[model samples]
Target: MLKIFLSSTYRDLVEYRAKILDKLDTVFDSVGMEEFIPDGKTSHEICIGDLKKSDIVIFLLSSNYGSLIDVCRLKEDCKAECPMKTGESHISYTHCEFKTVIAEGILHQTYKVLKGWDTQDKKEAILFEEEF
Candidate 1:
């Protein structure tokens, strides 16, 4: 079975992620941060490990950048066209995963949410809290 790693901002893309999992979880070996449990590994390392193991990746990009992580080491290790700016201290987890997939040559697809579609992440968080 082909494993798919879903990458996106948790808050803004909650609905989209849930929908994708609901629709695709059974059809494919779908893995995302939601399913991750603490295993004595940093999120960056865990995500990178998962991305390497996945056969393909699906990225849902939005205006939100997600949590910014220090990418100094990861950036240095990348051999692909990482769009990181010079002297940048941090990069978002979503962006990091996206870059890692590219750097490792993993098959991937991306769905971009329109900028005009406002992010109601805060409100959605409360409404969906424990709802799923």
Candidate 2:
């Protein structure tokens, strides 16, 4: 089975993520932080490890950049000083996952969700491309 990693901000893409899972469930093994990460393991560790094992990584970019909450630290104080190219003071966990996917030289694709546009068409395009 092809192991696929779905990366996105949870709050913004919950419905989209569900739809993807529904489609992928029959054909591929899908891993998303919301459904796959176990309670005992640290999210950072699991994300990087699973991402490396995945056949492909798909990133969903939406309007909200999302917030970074440190799972390891108490009181969510941790912030990653992202590289200059990222153009941000701090990076979220989702950002870290993206970087990991890149650093590991994993097969990946990204799709941007335009505001007020039909997402279903864009999602279908992404899925179609992935199929071939």
**Alpha-carbon lDDT of model 1:** 0.72
Model 2: weakest 10-residue lDDT segment is 72-81
Which regions of candidate 2 fall more than 4 Å away from where they truly are?
37-39, 69-89, 116-132
Candidate 2, residues 3-120, lDDT tens digits: the string is: 9899887887899999997788779999887776476867767776687889999888765555654443312322323342344334566666665666667899888766634544
> Each model's RMSD to truth, in Å?
7.7, 8.0
How high is each candidate's TM-score? 0.76, 0.69
Highest TM-score against the true fold, candidate: 1
lDDT of 2 at 79: 37
Look at candidate 1 and tell me the lDDT of residue 38. 83
